[model samples]
Target: MARPRAPNRRATSCRCSWTICIEPDQGTRVKQRPGGMPPHPSQVLARRGLVTSLTWLALVAAPTVAQAQFGDPGGEGTAATDTGQIGAAALSTPRYMGADHNRLRALPYLSYRWANGWFVDGINGVGYGGSPTPGLQMGVHVGVSPDREESDDPALRGMGNVNRGAELGGFAHQRLGSWLGGKLSLRSHLRYGSGEDRQGGQAELGLGWGTRLGERSLMNLGLAANWANQGYMQTYFGVTRAQSTSSGYTEHKTDGGLRDLRLSLVVIQLFSPTTVGLLMVSQTYWQGDAADSPLVQEKRNTMAVAALMYRF
Candidate 1:
Protein backbone atom coordinates (compact mmCIF):
# COMPACT_ATOMS: atom_id res chain seq x y z
CA MET A 1 0.00 0.00 0.00
CA ALA A 2 1.21 3.53 -0.87
CA ARG A 3 1.01 6.51 1.42
CA PRO A 4 -1.54 9.21 0.49
CA ARG A 5 -0.16 12.58 -0.70
CA ALA A 6 -0.85 15.76 1.31
CA PRO A 7 -3.65 18.00 0.01
CA ASN A 8 -2.41 21.02 -2.02
CA ARG A 9 -3.22 24.15 0.02
CA ARG A 10 -2.16 26.57 -2.73
CA ALA A 11 -4.89 25.35 -5.13
CA THR A 12 -7.57 25.82 -2.47
CA SER A 13 -6.50 29.04 -0.76
CA CYS A 14 -6.42 32.62 -2.05
CA ARG A 15 -5.20 34.05 1.29
CA CYS A 16 -1.60 35.21 1.40
CA SER A 17 0.83 33.64 3.90
CA TRP A 18 3.04 36.75 3.80
CA THR A 19 2.76 40.34 2.65
CA ILE A 20 5.20 42.67 0.87
CA CYS A 21 4.95 46.42 0.41
CA ILE A 22 7.08 49.28 -0.87
CA GLU A 23 8.22 52.09 1.41
CA PRO A 24 9.16 55.49 0.04
CA ASP A 25 12.43 55.77 1.95
CA GLN A 26 13.41 52.13 2.55
CA GLY A 27 12.33 50.39 -0.66
CA THR A 28 10.62 46.98 -0.59
CA ARG A 29 10.00 45.23 2.75
CA VAL A 30 8.49 41.84 3.42
CA LYS A 31 6.45 40.74 6.42
CA GLN A 32 7.36 37.57 8.28
CA ARG A 33 6.00 34.30 6.93
CA PRO A 34 4.58 31.89 9.56
CA GLY A 35 6.09 28.72 8.13
CA GLY A 36 8.76 29.88 5.66
CA MET A 37 6.49 28.79 2.85
CA PRO A 38 6.41 30.05 -0.72
CA PRO A 39 4.78 33.42 -1.44
CA HIS A 40 1.00 33.20 -1.73
CA PRO A 41 -0.85 33.93 -5.01
CA SER A 42 -2.00 37.36 -3.82
CA GLN A 43 1.55 38.30 -2.84
CA VAL A 44 2.82 37.34 -6.28
CA LEU A 45 0.08 39.43 -7.91
CA ALA A 46 0.93 42.42 -5.75
CA ARG A 47 4.61 42.19 -6.64
CA ARG A 48 3.77 42.13 -10.32
CA GLY A 49 1.57 45.22 -9.98
CA LEU A 50 4.33 47.13 -8.20
CA VAL A 51 6.83 46.34 -10.91
CA THR A 52 4.43 47.38 -13.65
CA SER A 53 3.71 50.69 -11.97
CA LEU A 54 7.42 51.50 -11.56
CA THR A 55 8.21 50.69 -15.17
CA TRP A 56 5.45 52.96 -16.40
CA LEU A 57 6.66 55.77 -14.18
CA ALA A 58 10.19 55.49 -15.51
CA LEU A 59 9.01 55.62 -19.12
CA VAL A 60 6.90 58.69 -18.49
CA ALA A 61 9.78 60.65 -16.91
CA ALA A 62 12.64 59.51 -19.14
CA PRO A 63 13.88 61.35 -22.21
CA THR A 64 13.00 60.27 -25.75
CA VAL A 65 15.26 57.71 -27.42
CA ALA A 66 17.96 58.43 -30.01
CA GLN A 67 17.28 57.93 -33.69
CA ALA A 68 20.11 56.29 -35.67
CA GLN A 69 20.60 57.76 -39.12
CA PHE A 70 22.99 55.07 -40.28
CA GLY A 71 21.69 51.68 -39.12
CA ASP A 72 20.61 49.85 -35.97
CA PRO A 73 23.72 48.60 -34.17
CA GLY A 74 22.26 45.52 -32.47
CA GLY A 75 19.63 44.27 -34.90
CA GLU A 76 21.40 41.11 -36.05
CA GLY A 77 21.66 39.16 -32.84
CA THR A 78 19.41 36.45 -31.44
CA ALA A 79 16.22 37.21 -29.56
CA ALA A 80 16.86 39.28 -26.46
CA THR A 81 15.59 39.13 -22.91
CA ASP A 82 12.90 41.60 -21.87
CA THR A 83 14.56 44.92 -21.06
CA GLY A 84 14.38 48.65 -21.42
CA GLN A 85 16.90 51.50 -21.67
CA ILE A 86 16.78 55.27 -21.49
CA GLY A 87 19.44 57.86 -22.23
CA ALA A 88 20.58 60.93 -24.13
CA ALA A 89 22.97 61.74 -26.99
CA ALA A 90 25.02 64.60 -28.40
CA LEU A 91 24.93 64.66 -32.19
CA SER A 92 26.81 66.65 -34.86
CA THR A 93 25.78 66.43 -38.47
CA PRO A 94 25.08 68.45 -41.58
CA ARG A 95 22.02 70.67 -41.26
CA TYR A 96 20.73 69.22 -44.49
CA MET A 97 21.78 66.26 -46.63
CA GLY A 98 24.11 68.23 -48.92
CA ALA A 99 24.98 71.13 -46.64
CA ASP A 100 28.62 72.05 -46.18
CA HIS A 101 28.15 73.05 -42.55
CA ASN A 102 27.43 70.98 -39.46
CA ARG A 103 25.05 71.61 -36.54
CA LEU A 104 25.15 70.27 -32.99
CA ARG A 105 22.11 69.06 -31.10
CA ALA A 106 21.14 67.15 -27.98
CA LEU A 107 18.79 64.19 -28.32
CA PRO A 108 17.09 61.80 -25.92
CA TYR A 109 16.96 58.01 -26.22
CA LEU A 110 14.59 55.31 -24.92
CA SER A 111 13.91 51.72 -26.00
CA TYR A 112 12.12 48.64 -24.74
CA ARG A 113 12.02 45.01 -25.82
CA TRP A 114 9.92 42.01 -24.86
CA ALA A 115 11.00 38.39 -24.70
CA ASN A 116 8.44 37.42 -27.33
CA GLY A 117 9.94 39.32 -30.27
CA TRP A 118 8.21 42.64 -29.76
CA PHE A 119 10.03 45.98 -29.47
CA VAL A 120 9.54 49.69 -29.47
CA ASP A 121 12.76 51.52 -30.28
CA GLY A 122 13.90 54.97 -31.24
CA ILE A 123 16.06 53.59 -34.01
CA ASN A 124 14.02 50.69 -35.38
CA GLY A 125 10.58 52.13 -34.64
CA VAL A 126 7.71 50.10 -33.14
CA GLY A 127 7.71 46.59 -34.54
CA TYR A 128 7.73 42.86 -33.93
CA GLY A 129 10.94 41.06 -34.87
CA GLY A 130 12.41 37.61 -34.39
CA SER A 131 15.08 35.24 -35.53
CA PRO A 132 13.47 32.48 -37.58
CA THR A 133 16.88 30.81 -37.61
CA PRO A 134 20.11 31.43 -35.80
CA GLY A 135 21.84 34.58 -37.03
CA LEU A 136 18.99 35.93 -39.17
CA GLN A 137 16.31 38.45 -38.19
CA MET A 138 13.55 40.09 -40.19
CA GLY A 139 10.79 42.53 -39.37
CA VAL A 140 8.58 45.37 -40.58
CA HIS A 141 7.98 48.77 -39.00
CA VAL A 142 6.18 52.05 -39.42
CA GLY A 143 8.09 55.26 -38.75
CA VAL A 144 8.35 58.91 -39.54
CA SER A 145 10.25 60.03 -42.63
CA PRO A 146 12.72 62.88 -42.29
CA ASP A 147 11.95 66.33 -43.68
CA ARG A 148 14.14 69.02 -45.21
CA GLU A 149 13.78 72.70 -44.33
CA GLU A 150 14.71 75.36 -46.82
CA SER A 151 15.93 77.62 -43.98
CA ASP A 152 18.52 75.03 -42.95
CA ASP A 153 20.98 76.29 -45.61
CA PRO A 154 21.55 79.55 -47.44
CA ALA A 155 21.70 77.67 -50.74
CA LEU A 156 18.05 76.72 -50.29
CA ARG A 157 16.75 80.29 -50.19
CA GLY A 158 14.10 79.47 -52.76
CA MET A 159 13.61 75.74 -52.38
CA GLY A 160 10.53 75.00 -50.24
CA ASN A 161 10.41 72.75 -47.21
CA VAL A 162 9.82 69.07 -47.60
CA ASN A 163 7.30 68.21 -44.90
CA ARG A 164 7.72 65.10 -42.80
CA GLY A 165 5.32 62.20 -43.12
CA ALA A 166 4.75 58.57 -42.14
CA GLU A 167 6.61 55.71 -43.78
CA LEU A 168 6.11 51.94 -43.98
CA GLY A 169 9.19 49.79 -44.19
CA GLY A 170 10.82 46.44 -43.61
CA PHE A 171 14.33 45.37 -42.65
CA ALA A 172 16.38 42.20 -42.74
CA HIS A 173 19.71 41.32 -41.17
CA GLN A 174 21.85 38.23 -41.67
CA ARG A 175 25.04 37.23 -39.91
CA LEU A 176 27.39 35.83 -42.56
CA GLY A 177 30.24 34.48 -40.46
CA SER A 178 33.47 35.58 -38.82
CA TRP A 179 36.09 37.73 -40.47
CA LEU A 180 39.34 38.84 -38.87
CA GLY A 181 38.13 37.86 -35.41
CA GLY A 182 34.95 39.91 -35.94
CA LYS A 183 31.35 39.01 -36.70
CA LEU A 184 30.30 39.99 -40.22
CA SER A 185 26.73 40.68 -41.29
CA LEU A 186 24.65 42.04 -44.13
CA ARG A 187 21.57 44.29 -43.78
CA SER A 188 18.93 45.73 -46.06
CA HIS A 189 16.08 48.23 -45.65
CA LEU A 190 13.30 49.60 -47.84
CA ARG A 191 10.79 52.34 -47.16
CA TYR A 192 8.28 54.55 -48.94
CA GLY A 193 7.04 58.00 -47.93
CA SER A 194 8.04 61.68 -47.60
CA GLY A 195 8.11 63.68 -50.82
CA GLU A 196 6.22 66.48 -52.46
CA ASP A 197 3.54 63.89 -53.20
CA ARG A 198 4.47 61.54 -50.38
CA GLN A 199 5.33 58.67 -52.70
CA GLY A 200 9.13 58.65 -52.52
CA GLY A 201 10.74 55.25 -52.04
CA GLN A 202 14.29 54.32 -51.07
CA ALA A 203 16.34 51.21 -50.36
CA GLU A 204 19.64 50.50 -48.65
CA LEU A 205 22.01 47.52 -48.48
CA GLY A 206 24.99 47.37 -46.19
CA LEU A 207 27.69 45.25 -44.62
CA GLY A 208 28.77 45.42 -40.99
CA TRP A 209 31.61 43.94 -38.96
CA GLY A 210 31.60 43.93 -35.16
CA THR A 211 34.11 42.71 -32.59
CA ARG A 212 34.66 42.79 -28.87
CA LEU A 213 37.52 45.02 -27.76
CA GLY A 214 37.65 44.05 -24.09
CA GLU A 215 35.55 42.64 -21.29
CA ARG A 216 33.16 45.57 -21.55
CA SER A 217 33.84 47.24 -24.89
CA LEU A 218 32.81 46.56 -28.50
CA MET A 219 33.36 48.15 -31.91
CA ASN A 220 31.53 48.03 -35.24
CA LEU A 221 32.26 49.22 -38.77
CA GLY A 222 29.65 49.63 -41.50
CA LEU A 223 29.44 50.47 -45.21
CA ALA A 224 26.24 50.98 -47.18
CA ALA A 225 24.82 52.26 -50.46
CA ASN A 226 21.41 53.84 -51.06
CA TRP A 227 19.15 53.83 -54.10
CA ALA A 228 16.15 56.04 -54.76
CA ASN A 229 13.08 56.03 -56.99
CA GLN A 230 12.16 58.80 -59.43
CA GLY A 231 9.85 60.44 -56.93
CA TYR A 232 12.57 60.72 -54.34
CA MET A 233 15.26 61.91 -56.78
CA GLN A 234 13.02 64.51 -58.36
CA THR A 235 11.73 65.92 -55.10
CA TYR A 236 15.14 66.44 -53.52
CA PHE A 237 17.46 66.87 -56.53
CA GLY A 238 15.38 68.35 -59.34
CA VAL A 239 14.42 71.95 -60.07
CA THR A 240 11.40 73.18 -62.01
CA ARG A 241 11.42 76.11 -64.50
CA ALA A 242 9.45 78.33 -62.11
CA GLN A 243 11.67 77.45 -59.14
CA SER A 244 14.83 77.80 -61.23
CA THR A 245 13.88 81.40 -62.08
CA SER A 246 13.09 82.23 -58.42
CA SER A 247 16.32 80.68 -57.15
CA GLY A 248 18.53 81.89 -60.04
CA TYR A 249 19.57 78.28 -60.77
CA THR A 250 19.23 76.09 -63.86
CA GLU A 251 16.15 73.91 -64.18
CA HIS A 252 17.40 70.38 -63.60
CA LYS A 253 15.55 67.12 -64.25
CA THR A 254 16.50 63.99 -62.34
CA ASP A 255 16.18 60.27 -62.98
CA GLY A 256 16.21 57.67 -60.24
CA GLY A 257 19.29 55.51 -59.54
CA LEU A 258 22.14 55.26 -57.03
CA ARG A 259 21.97 58.07 -54.51
CA ASP A 260 24.80 57.88 -51.96
CA LEU A 261 27.31 55.74 -50.08
CA ARG A 262 27.99 55.80 -46.35
CA LEU A 263 30.72 54.51 -44.07
CA SER A 264 30.55 54.46 -40.28
CA LEU A 265 32.37 53.31 -37.16
CA VAL A 266 30.86 52.86 -33.71
CA VAL A 267 32.26 51.96 -30.30
CA ILE A 268 30.34 50.95 -27.21
CA GLN A 269 31.49 50.74 -23.59
CA LEU A 270 29.60 49.12 -20.76
CA PHE A 271 30.03 51.18 -17.63
CA SER A 272 28.15 48.54 -15.61
CA PRO A 273 25.50 45.90 -16.09
CA THR A 274 22.92 48.68 -16.19
CA THR A 275 24.79 51.55 -17.83
CA VAL A 276 26.41 52.07 -21.27
CA GLY A 277 28.20 54.68 -23.38
CA LEU A 278 28.52 54.96 -27.14
CA LEU A 279 30.49 56.94 -29.73
CA MET A 280 30.03 56.96 -33.49
CA VAL A 281 31.49 58.69 -36.57
CA SER A 282 30.31 58.50 -40.14
CA GLN A 283 30.86 59.92 -43.63
CA THR A 284 28.58 60.09 -46.64
CA TYR A 285 29.29 60.68 -50.36
CA TRP A 286 26.55 61.75 -52.72
CA GLN A 287 26.58 60.59 -56.34
CA GLY A 288 24.47 60.48 -59.53
CA ASP A 289 21.50 62.86 -59.62
CA ALA A 290 21.85 63.76 -55.96
CA ALA A 291 25.35 65.21 -56.48
CA ASP A 292 24.44 66.96 -59.72
CA SER A 293 21.68 69.03 -58.08
CA PRO A 294 22.43 72.71 -57.60
CA LEU A 295 21.01 72.36 -54.10
CA VAL A 296 23.99 70.19 -53.23
CA GLN A 297 26.47 72.70 -51.92
CA GLU A 298 28.64 69.80 -50.79
CA LYS A 299 28.65 66.20 -51.93
CA ARG A 300 30.41 64.83 -48.89
CA ASN A 301 29.05 64.97 -45.34
CA THR A 302 30.32 64.00 -41.89
CA MET A 303 28.49 63.18 -38.67
CA ALA A 304 29.36 62.21 -35.10
CA VAL A 305 27.53 61.23 -31.92
CA ALA A 306 28.14 60.50 -28.24
CA ALA A 307 25.52 58.91 -26.03
CA LEU A 308 24.89 57.48 -22.55
CA MET A 309 22.26 54.85 -21.75
CA TYR A 310 20.76 53.19 -18.66
CA ARG A 311 19.23 49.72 -18.88
CA PHE A 312 16.62 48.09 -16.65
Candidate 2:
Protein backbone atom coordinates (compact mmCIF):
# COMPACT_ATOMS: atom_id res chain seq x y z
CA MET A 1 0.00 0.00 0.00
CA ALA A 2 1.20 3.55 -0.78
CA ARG A 3 2.05 5.82 2.12
CA PRO A 4 -0.59 8.47 2.89
CA ARG A 5 0.52 12.04 2.26
CA ALA A 6 0.48 14.60 5.04
CA PRO A 7 -2.60 16.75 5.39
CA ASN A 8 -2.56 20.48 4.57
CA ARG A 9 -3.40 22.33 7.75
CA ARG A 10 -4.42 25.38 5.72
CA ALA A 11 -7.13 23.53 3.89
CA THR A 12 -10.52 22.35 5.13
CA SER A 13 -11.14 18.62 5.64
CA CYS A 14 -12.10 16.93 2.38
CA ARG A 15 -11.81 13.45 0.90
CA CYS A 16 -9.69 14.26 -2.23
CA SER A 17 -6.04 15.24 -1.85
CA TRP A 18 -4.38 17.70 -4.18
CA THR A 19 -0.69 18.48 -4.35
CA ILE A 20 0.04 21.56 -6.45
CA CYS A 21 3.71 22.36 -6.75
CA ILE A 22 4.68 25.54 -8.57
CA GLU A 23 8.19 24.17 -8.91
CA PRO A 24 8.67 20.55 -8.02
CA ASP A 25 12.46 20.83 -8.17
CA GLN A 26 12.35 23.63 -5.56
CA GLY A 27 9.90 21.79 -3.29
CA THR A 28 7.35 24.57 -3.47
CA ARG A 29 3.91 23.11 -2.97
CA VAL A 30 0.29 24.11 -2.34
CA LYS A 31 -1.48 21.07 -0.98
CA GLN A 32 -5.18 20.87 -0.33
CA ARG A 33 -7.47 17.91 0.36
CA PRO A 34 -10.65 19.60 -0.73
CA GLY A 35 -11.34 19.10 -4.47
CA GLY A 36 -14.31 21.45 -4.68
CA MET A 37 -13.06 24.06 -2.31
CA PRO A 38 -13.03 27.69 -3.41
CA PRO A 39 -10.27 30.17 -2.73
CA HIS A 40 -10.27 31.86 0.67
CA PRO A 41 -12.14 35.14 0.89
CA SER A 42 -9.03 37.06 1.85
CA GLN A 43 -7.11 35.61 -1.07
CA VAL A 44 -9.91 36.51 -3.44
CA LEU A 45 -10.05 40.08 -2.12
CA ALA A 46 -6.30 40.50 -2.34
CA ARG A 47 -6.28 39.29 -5.93
CA ARG A 48 -9.05 41.67 -6.89
CA GLY A 49 -7.30 44.60 -5.25
CA LEU A 50 -4.06 43.77 -7.04
CA VAL A 51 -5.82 43.63 -10.38
CA THR A 52 -7.50 46.98 -9.83
CA SER A 53 -4.24 48.64 -8.84
CA LEU A 54 -2.40 47.21 -11.82
CA THR A 55 -5.07 48.41 -14.20
CA TRP A 56 -4.87 51.91 -12.75
CA LEU A 57 -1.10 51.87 -12.98
CA ALA A 58 -1.20 50.76 -16.60
CA LEU A 59 -3.54 53.58 -17.51
CA VAL A 60 -1.17 56.15 -15.97
CA ALA A 61 2.09 54.72 -17.34
CA ALA A 62 1.35 54.39 -21.04
CA PRO A 63 1.52 58.09 -21.92
CA THR A 64 4.71 58.71 -20.02
CA VAL A 65 6.41 55.74 -21.66
CA ALA A 66 5.25 56.89 -25.06
CA GLN A 67 6.68 60.32 -24.41
CA ALA A 68 9.96 58.88 -23.16
CA GLN A 69 10.29 56.71 -26.26
CA PHE A 70 10.84 59.96 -28.19
CA GLY A 71 8.78 58.70 -31.11
CA ASP A 72 10.62 55.37 -31.27
CA PRO A 73 7.58 53.37 -30.03
CA GLY A 74 9.44 50.06 -29.53
CA GLY A 75 8.48 49.41 -25.89
CA GLU A 76 4.94 48.13 -26.40
CA GLY A 77 5.61 44.43 -26.20
CA THR A 78 3.52 42.50 -23.67
CA ALA A 79 5.36 41.42 -20.54
CA ALA A 80 4.59 39.09 -17.64
CA THR A 81 5.47 41.70 -15.05
CA ASP A 82 4.42 45.27 -14.43
CA THR A 83 6.80 48.22 -14.96
CA GLY A 84 6.46 51.74 -13.64
CA GLN A 85 8.24 54.99 -12.85
CA ILE A 86 8.06 57.07 -9.69
CA GLY A 87 9.32 60.59 -9.46
CA ALA A 88 8.65 64.17 -8.54
CA ALA A 89 8.57 67.34 -10.63
CA ALA A 90 9.04 70.94 -9.69
CA LEU A 91 6.75 73.09 -11.82
CA SER A 92 6.70 76.85 -12.27
CA THR A 93 3.30 78.17 -13.30
CA PRO A 94 1.12 81.25 -13.05
CA ARG A 95 -1.36 81.38 -10.21
CA TYR A 96 -4.03 81.85 -12.81
CA MET A 97 -4.01 83.09 -16.41
CA GLY A 98 -2.56 86.51 -15.72
CA ALA A 99 -1.83 86.54 -12.00
CA ASP A 100 1.57 88.00 -11.10
CA HIS A 101 1.96 85.53 -8.26
CA ASN A 102 3.89 82.72 -9.88
CA ARG A 103 4.12 79.66 -7.69
CA LEU A 104 6.72 76.90 -7.81
CA ARG A 105 5.01 73.66 -6.96
CA ALA A 106 6.30 70.15 -6.52
CA LEU A 107 4.08 67.51 -8.02
CA PRO A 108 4.33 63.73 -7.91
CA TYR A 109 5.07 61.99 -11.16
CA LEU A 110 4.00 58.38 -11.56
CA SER A 111 3.48 56.10 -14.50
CA TYR A 112 2.96 52.37 -14.87
CA ARG A 113 2.70 49.72 -17.51
CA TRP A 114 0.67 46.67 -16.43
CA ALA A 115 1.00 45.12 -19.88
CA ASN A 116 1.78 45.93 -23.48
CA GLY A 117 -0.34 48.66 -25.09
CA TRP A 118 -1.72 49.91 -21.79
CA PHE A 119 -0.24 52.64 -19.57
CA VAL A 120 -1.04 55.59 -17.35
CA ASP A 121 0.96 58.80 -17.06
CA GLY A 122 0.29 60.76 -13.90
CA ILE A 123 1.25 64.12 -15.33
CA ASN A 124 -0.49 63.56 -18.62
CA GLY A 125 -3.40 61.62 -17.12
CA VAL A 126 -4.55 58.01 -17.76
CA GLY A 127 -5.01 56.48 -21.19
CA TYR A 128 -4.37 53.53 -23.52
CA GLY A 129 -2.41 53.70 -26.72
CA GLY A 130 -1.07 51.31 -29.32
CA SER A 131 2.60 50.49 -29.71
CA PRO A 132 4.78 53.09 -31.41
CA THR A 133 5.95 50.56 -34.01
CA PRO A 134 2.61 50.94 -35.72
CA GLY A 135 3.28 54.59 -36.73
CA LEU A 136 -0.42 55.31 -36.12
CA GLN A 137 -2.03 55.12 -32.74
CA MET A 138 -5.05 56.38 -30.84
CA GLY A 139 -6.12 56.52 -27.23
CA VAL A 140 -8.78 57.63 -24.76
CA HIS A 141 -7.82 59.63 -21.72
CA VAL A 142 -9.15 61.36 -18.60
CA GLY A 143 -7.54 64.15 -16.64
CA VAL A 144 -8.33 66.68 -13.92
CA SER A 145 -7.98 70.42 -14.14
CA PRO A 146 -5.90 72.25 -11.64
CA ASP A 147 -7.74 73.82 -8.76
CA ARG A 148 -8.13 77.60 -8.90
CA GLU A 149 -8.40 79.15 -5.47
CA GLU A 150 -9.17 82.73 -4.44
CA SER A 151 -6.01 82.77 -2.37
CA ASP A 152 -3.69 82.10 -5.29
CA ASP A 153 -3.78 85.75 -6.31
CA PRO A 154 -5.01 89.03 -4.88
CA ALA A 155 -7.05 89.56 -8.04
CA LEU A 156 -8.85 86.30 -7.41
CA ARG A 157 -9.83 87.22 -3.82
CA GLY A 158 -13.51 87.47 -4.66
CA MET A 159 -13.66 85.22 -7.71
CA GLY A 160 -13.95 82.20 -5.42
CA ASN A 161 -12.41 78.88 -6.39
CA VAL A 162 -12.74 77.23 -9.72
CA ASN A 163 -12.93 73.78 -8.23
CA ARG A 164 -10.93 71.11 -9.95
CA GLY A 165 -12.99 68.92 -12.21
CA ALA A 166 -12.56 65.88 -14.44
CA GLU A 167 -11.76 66.05 -18.11
CA LEU A 168 -12.28 63.15 -20.53
CA GLY A 169 -10.92 63.03 -24.00
CA GLY A 170 -9.36 61.11 -26.86
CA PHE A 171 -6.14 61.52 -28.79
CA ALA A 172 -4.58 60.45 -32.07
CA HIS A 173 -0.96 60.27 -33.16
CA GLN A 174 0.56 59.71 -36.57
CA ARG A 175 4.23 59.38 -37.43
CA LEU A 176 5.13 61.30 -40.57
CA GLY A 177 8.38 59.51 -41.23
CA SER A 178 11.84 60.95 -40.61
CA TRP A 179 12.61 64.60 -41.04
CA LEU A 180 15.54 66.69 -39.89
CA GLY A 181 17.14 63.38 -38.83
CA GLY A 182 14.29 62.78 -36.37
CA LYS A 183 10.87 61.26 -36.28
CA LEU A 184 8.16 63.73 -37.27
CA SER A 185 4.62 63.36 -36.01
CA LEU A 186 1.20 64.92 -35.77
CA ARG A 187 -0.93 64.72 -32.66
CA SER A 188 -4.29 65.97 -31.47
CA HIS A 189 -6.53 65.64 -28.44
CA LEU A 190 -9.95 66.93 -27.43
CA ARG A 191 -11.05 67.10 -23.84
CA TYR A 192 -14.34 67.97 -22.15
CA GLY A 193 -14.48 69.00 -18.50
CA SER A 194 -17.40 68.13 -16.27
CA GLY A 195 -18.37 70.83 -13.80
CA GLU A 196 -21.70 72.46 -13.02
CA ASP A 197 -20.35 75.90 -13.87
CA ARG A 198 -17.33 74.86 -15.91
CA GLN A 199 -18.41 71.97 -18.06
CA GLY A 200 -16.67 73.03 -21.23
CA GLY A 201 -14.39 71.62 -23.87
CA GLN A 202 -11.03 72.30 -25.45
CA ALA A 203 -9.07 70.99 -28.43
CA GLU A 204 -5.43 70.78 -29.33
CA LEU A 205 -3.40 70.20 -32.48
CA GLY A 206 0.31 69.86 -32.73
CA LEU A 207 3.28 68.92 -34.89
CA GLY A 208 6.42 67.57 -33.33
CA TRP A 209 9.75 65.90 -33.92
CA GLY A 210 11.84 63.73 -31.64
CA THR A 211 15.41 62.50 -31.84
CA ARG A 212 17.65 60.26 -29.80
CA LEU A 213 20.69 62.17 -28.48
CA GLY A 214 22.77 59.14 -27.47
CA GLU A 215 22.44 55.75 -25.82
CA ARG A 216 20.42 57.16 -22.96
CA SER A 217 19.16 60.59 -23.92
CA LEU A 218 16.32 61.86 -26.09
CA MET A 219 14.81 65.23 -27.06
CA ASN A 220 11.57 66.46 -28.59
CA LEU A 221 10.21 69.78 -29.90
CA GLY A 222 6.66 70.66 -30.74
CA LEU A 223 4.30 73.47 -31.64
CA ALA A 224 0.63 73.33 -30.77
CA ALA A 225 -2.60 75.26 -31.22
CA ASN A 226 -5.37 75.33 -28.65
CA TRP A 227 -9.06 76.11 -29.09
CA ALA A 228 -11.79 76.56 -26.53
CA ASN A 229 -15.57 76.49 -26.60
CA GLN A 230 -17.85 79.32 -25.55
CA GLY A 231 -18.61 77.69 -22.25
CA TYR A 232 -14.95 77.30 -21.44
CA MET A 233 -14.23 80.88 -22.37
CA GLN A 234 -17.06 82.11 -20.20
CA THR A 235 -16.12 80.10 -17.18
CA TYR A 236 -12.52 81.28 -17.02
CA PHE A 237 -12.57 84.65 -18.77
CA GLY A 238 -16.10 86.02 -18.50
CA VAL A 239 -17.49 88.16 -15.72
CA THR A 240 -21.20 87.89 -15.13
CA ARG A 241 -23.46 90.74 -13.96
CA ALA A 242 -23.49 89.50 -10.38
CA GLN A 243 -19.75 88.78 -10.37
CA SER A 244 -19.08 92.25 -11.74
CA THR A 245 -21.14 93.87 -8.98
CA SER A 246 -19.36 91.91 -6.27
CA SER A 247 -15.87 91.93 -7.74
CA GLY A 248 -15.90 95.55 -8.96
CA TYR A 249 -15.14 94.48 -12.55
CA THR A 250 -17.21 95.36 -15.60
CA GLU A 251 -19.57 92.67 -16.81
CA HIS A 252 -17.92 90.94 -19.73
CA LYS A 253 -19.26 88.39 -22.15
CA THR A 254 -16.95 86.40 -24.35
CA ASP A 255 -17.08 83.96 -27.24
CA GLY A 256 -14.80 80.98 -27.68
CA GLY A 257 -12.26 80.57 -30.46
CA LEU A 258 -8.51 80.36 -30.64
CA ARG A 259 -7.14 80.19 -27.12
CA ASP A 260 -3.41 79.99 -27.41
CA LEU A 261 -0.35 78.97 -29.41
CA ARG A 262 2.28 76.93 -27.66
CA LEU A 263 5.87 75.94 -28.27
CA SER A 264 7.39 73.21 -26.15
CA LEU A 265 10.55 71.18 -25.73
CA VAL A 266 11.23 68.08 -23.67
CA VAL A 267 14.50 66.35 -22.90
CA ILE A 268 14.95 63.02 -21.18
CA GLN A 269 18.07 61.33 -19.84
CA LEU A 270 18.24 57.73 -18.74
CA PHE A 271 20.70 57.25 -15.87
CA SER A 272 20.24 53.50 -15.77
CA PRO A 273 17.93 50.80 -17.03
CA THR A 274 15.49 51.83 -14.32
CA THR A 275 16.16 55.51 -13.73
CA VAL A 276 15.47 58.65 -15.76
CA GLY A 277 15.51 62.44 -15.57
CA LEU A 278 13.36 64.83 -17.57
CA LEU A 279 13.12 68.54 -18.27
CA MET A 280 10.31 70.31 -20.05
CA VAL A 281 9.86 73.93 -21.13
CA SER A 282 6.78 75.40 -22.69
CA GLN A 283 5.67 78.91 -23.68
CA THR A 284 2.13 79.92 -24.39
CA TYR A 285 0.81 83.02 -26.17
CA TRP A 286 -2.78 83.74 -25.23
CA GLN A 287 -5.02 84.72 -28.11
CA GLY A 288 -8.40 86.32 -28.75
CA ASP A 289 -10.79 86.49 -25.81
CA ALA A 290 -8.52 84.64 -23.45
CA ALA A 291 -6.00 87.43 -23.77
CA ASP A 292 -8.59 90.15 -23.60
CA SER A 293 -10.19 89.11 -20.31
CA PRO A 294 -9.65 91.20 -17.20
CA LEU A 295 -8.57 87.99 -15.55
CA VAL A 296 -5.74 87.66 -18.02
CA GLN A 297 -2.92 89.96 -16.94
CA GLU A 298 -0.30 88.52 -19.23
CA LYS A 299 -0.53 87.52 -22.87
CA ARG A 300 2.58 85.38 -22.65
CA ASN A 301 3.08 82.49 -20.21
CA THR A 302 6.16 80.38 -19.65
CA MET A 303 6.43 77.14 -17.71
CA ALA A 304 9.27 74.78 -16.87
CA VAL A 305 9.50 71.45 -15.08
CA ALA A 306 12.33 69.23 -13.93
CA ALA A 307 11.76 65.68 -12.76
CA LEU A 308 13.71 62.60 -11.68
CA MET A 309 12.15 59.22 -12.38
CA TYR A 310 12.72 55.54 -11.61
CA ARG A 311 11.22 52.47 -13.23
CA PHE A 312 10.53 48.96 -11.88
Name the candidate that leads on lDDT: 1
The TM-score obtained by model 2 is 0.71
The C-alpha local distance difference test score for the whole of candidate 2 amounts to: 0.56
User: Which parts of model 2 have CA positions greater than 4 angstroms off?
Assistant: 1-81, 120-126, 131-133, 194-198
TM-score of every prediction relative to native: 0.75, 0.71
Model 2: which ten-residue window has the lowest total lDDT?
Answer: 41-50
lDDT of 2 at 46: 14
lDDT of 2 at 74: 17
lDDT of 1 by residue, 116-193 (tens): 656676644676665566556667777667677778778877887788778777777665766887767677778788
**Alpha carbon lDDT of residue 250, candidate 1?**
92
